[model samples]
Each structure stands twice: as C-alpha cells, then as structure tokens.
Target: MIYRIAMHNLSNPSDAEDIVQEVSLALLTKCPDDKDDIAVKHWLIRVTINKCKSFHRQFWQRKRESIDDYLHLEAPHQRGVMDEVLELPKKERNIIYLYYYERYSIRDIAEILHINANTVSSHLQRARKKLKSILTEGGTYHD
Candidate 1:
C-alpha cells in the first residue's frame, strides 16, 4: 500500500522504492507495539504521504522540473490515459488514484488524506470531468 501510494504520487518506481524503504524504517523505529494493525497501517500511509509531499517540495525547490519525465513507463496504447491522469493536479490525481485504483470510499479517502469527505467528492468529480474531456478530445472516450 505504501509503495502504491508513493508510485501514484511520485510516478517513478525508484522514488517509490525509496519512499517504501523510508516508511519501513520509520515504522520499525517509531511505531508503537500497542497499536492495532489497522492503526499501524493508517500511520504508515500518513507517513508515506507526508514523505511524498516533502520529496515533491524539495525537488521543486531544487529543480523546478515537471513530473512527466519521471512517469512510469507503460505500453504506448495505455500511456495516453495514464498521461491524462498524471496531468491532473496533485490533489485530483491523488483522489482519483485512491478512489479508483485503491478502491477506497470517499469517506475513507478523506480520512486517509486528512480532508473533508465533501472535498474528496468534489475533487473526484472534477477529476472525472477533466479526464472525460481529455479522453473525448483524443477520440478515446466511449462513454
């Protein structure tokens, strides 16, 4: 789960691997043994998200480069949709990835992301509209 969240945020497998390692180390050193499994998972996810955000901030401060160059390599045909998703703003992209790929409910996503449920729904709606427009413009949207 940590790796998936890192991949969705960072787009690079190597960066995602680094995030997973960092999260694992943090968990090992900081996590309380008394916490339940679910609580531990949530703590891990929160840490991973924070790490990804910090990484992005640091990278932007240093390089000001676009994330496109770091995107995961996929087949040519599938790249279009993936690219469209990647082109979304960070909040929308994270919402879409959590709602769809991670199969998380809006309330769950809100809790995980530390946002309101309505905010999550709004982001999801806007992201879907943006994706639809992009896909339709590319003549790839069927419905």
Candidate 2:
C-alpha cells in the first residue's frame, strides 16, 4: 500500500511515511464501528491522496525555489531525470506517477484521475518526450 501510494504521488519516502501516519490516524477517527476492512482500505487511500494534495499546497505556498534543488539534494545522480519529471505540469505529473510508479494501467489511471484514457495517454507521451530531452542534456544517465 505504501509503495503504491508513493509511486502514484511521486512522494519522497519521508513524505510518504508521514502521509501514511496521517492516514492511519484519520482512519481511527473516521471509521465507523462496523466498517469492514475493504471499506477501511478505500477510505485510507482517499485520505492519503488528500493529505498529499494538502502537503503540496502548503509546500508551494512557502516560496518558489528551483525544483532542481529538491532533485539534487535528494539524489544527485538521479536528480537530472527527477528534475524534468517534477517540472512537468501537475496533470502530467499525476498521470506519469500513476502509470509508471503505481504500475496502473491506462484505464485505471484515467479512472483514478477522473480523466479520459486518451488524455492520460497524451500526457504520458508529452511527458516522455520532455523527460527524454531533459535527461539527455545533463542527466545522470550520461556515460
């Protein structure tokens, strides 16, 4: 569950951990006495996504630093590719994260993101092109 959430959100391990903790707490508060495990899981996932969105909102409100800084500081060699990925428009970012990270099919990604499958595919195509160009320039993949 943690892996899926992290992948779908492109969240750092630390942030994922924090969100998971928040989800756990929220579940305890919100779940009814007779809620089944399946319902609990669904609620947790929804809460987790909400928490991630909230976190991003707060993070962006503070200041406008280079996204590259996050990439480099977190992982230098991988930073180049990550910088480009992070630079994508939010919709593209969400689509890529859902498809690649979460290992979701295009249909599933579209459902989760509440968009058409074709839109998800288009975003992915553009994201791939942008990532390829950005990484080719000064990415860690340079040999």
Tell me the spans in candidate 1 whose CA falls farther than 4 Å from its real position. 59-74, 133-143
lDDT values of the candidates?
A: 0.76, 0.63
lDDT tens digits, residue span 40-127, model 2? 6545555666677787866543443454444235457566566566678767776666566556778766665567989988998888
Question: Ten consecutive residues with minimal summed lDDT in candidate 2?
Answer: 134-143
Judging by lDDT against the true structure, name the best candidate: 1
Instruction: Give the 10-residue window scoring lowest on summed lDDT in candidate 1.
Output: 134-143
Q: Per-residue lDDT for 9-73 in model 1, tens only?
A: 77776778888999999999988899898778778877888898998766443433344555545
TM-score, predicted candidate 1 vs. hidden true structure: 0.74
TM-score, candidate number 2: 0.57
